[model samples]
Target: MVDELEKAKPIIIKRVKRKGHDFHGGSWKVAFADFATAMMAFFLLLWLMGNTSEDEKQAISGYFHDPSGFQEKAGSSPAVIGEGGANVAVIEIETIQPETDDIESEISKNEASNKPLSEEELAKLAEQKEIEKLKQLKKELEFLVENSIDFSQFREQVMIDITPSGLRIQIVDKDKRPMFDSGSAEPKYYSKTILRGLANVLKQVPNKLSVTGHTDATPYVERENYGNWELSADRANAARRELLFGGIKEKKIARVEGFSSSILFDQQNPHNPVNRRIAIIVLKRSVAENIEKQVLGVE
Candidate 1:
């Protein structure tokens, strides 16, 4: 029976079965994607080269070479074009020089029309400059006294202003806090600190200085020829010596005058404590010249 079954199956089971090929491998898709990417990169490069301005191109080139944008030495360098692979080219471009004929002609015309200032005009200009400088000095002194820790406490006592002569810095006396001992030219401890600071600032300026001393109108008995005038004069000279010791040049001192109660700080109250003060005047060069001329009777 087994032999008969085998023979029958062998004769009948001759059917054909067809199978489709595996998905044509996906490798072809990968190759197509790579081709598209390369084409996109090529087009982008073309757009950049065509549209970029000269300065933009130069800046990009500089960034590539030095990402940190720091130079070893400060100097001018020649501009560069794209310097790589396909666009590598050493272009030596010359800068366009601006025409200066019009400028030169304008300058020449101005020179021809200009006239030298007369003596009076020159003097007026000098006075204007001096006034401006004095104003600046006054502002600086005010700032120093107002801001400094050591000097700020004396802000009320220190007065800085621009005068007709030049800048005037005054350290006036308060009833309770006198800069000097009563009827004495000796400076208090705080007064020395202020003077030293002032000397340091005064040394920076080229202007000559004048120190004046004033006294209150209270009467004092003359003893051994020592009176208000001598006391005021001695005090002014004493302040001058302190300034010199604190580094102020002796040559910068133009004058030291003592007006014993003659110039009252408060005209209404002759015996006001504010009248007893030390006055430091920064004299402008022009003002000093005027004073000199007056002294010599040359004006």
Candidate 2:
């Protein structure tokens, strides 16, 4: 009975099925590959642009601007020159040219006309050029004075201005900062430094130069036969020598003069310190020409 009961006992078996994670799509991989390919093409395009010649670049630009214009004007012809077949033979090709060349040619034609300019017109042209050069020189000097620490300290004393005569550069004296020794023509060290620096700049312009010296109304009787007039003249000459030392040609100097308290900068105060100064003028072309003609005894 026991054996029959054991054999009749029920037996059970269970099985669990576990599902895997969801499958992610491959869209991002395709997008990333496309981005990488685009970057590579972009770099290749940049390299090509960097290596292309100006003419090739222009040709490419023209083709893009008007693709139809790049087509060759042609007619149907035989491929072997005897039998007629559907064939296009390019006879001519038109190219795009820059518009600036046309404008330049027009200007050149106008300027290179047969008729010569009158003397007055020539003078006006020369004057215009002289004015331009002087203005540029003035600008350079002003920039130097403003930006350079060496020149900034004496900015007030180093006065520069444009006048009808031409560019006028004045190195004037302060109350205690005289450019020269009192009652003497000897230039102070800093004064020589200033003159040499100015000379290097003045050498760039083709115009003739005029250097002048002036003194205040205070009378000087320190040396025999040496008054303000002689002192001023000597000072002017000394400045000229320094200019020559700084690489300016001697022929560039048109005149050296001295005015003893005659043209006081501050008219109200005759003895003002500012009256003592060195004035260097870059003469205009017309004036220089007139000077040359006069020296040559031409009417």
Q: What's each prediction's TM-score?
A: 0.61, 0.61
For model 1, the local distance difference test gives 0.72
lDDT of 2 by residue, 1-299 (tens): 99999999997778898875444567777888999999999999999999974434544554455544433421241111111121111111111112345444544665799655566755565566557667777766775565333454677889888887778999999988899979778888888877876776677666788899999999998788888999889888989999998778999998898998889999999999999999998888667677778889997
Which lDDT values do the candidates have, in the order given?
Answer: 0.72, 0.72
Total backbone clashes of candidate 2, pairs 3 or more residues apart or in separate chains: 0
Clashes within 3 Å, all models in order: 0, 0
lDDT per residue for candidate 1 within 1-299, as digits (tens), equals 99888878744566688775655778778988999999999999899989984435655665476644323311243332222211111122221111244334544665688955566755565566567666766655665575444575688999988787778999899979988887788998888878877886677777888998888898656477777888788889888988997789999898898888888999899989999989999887777777778878997
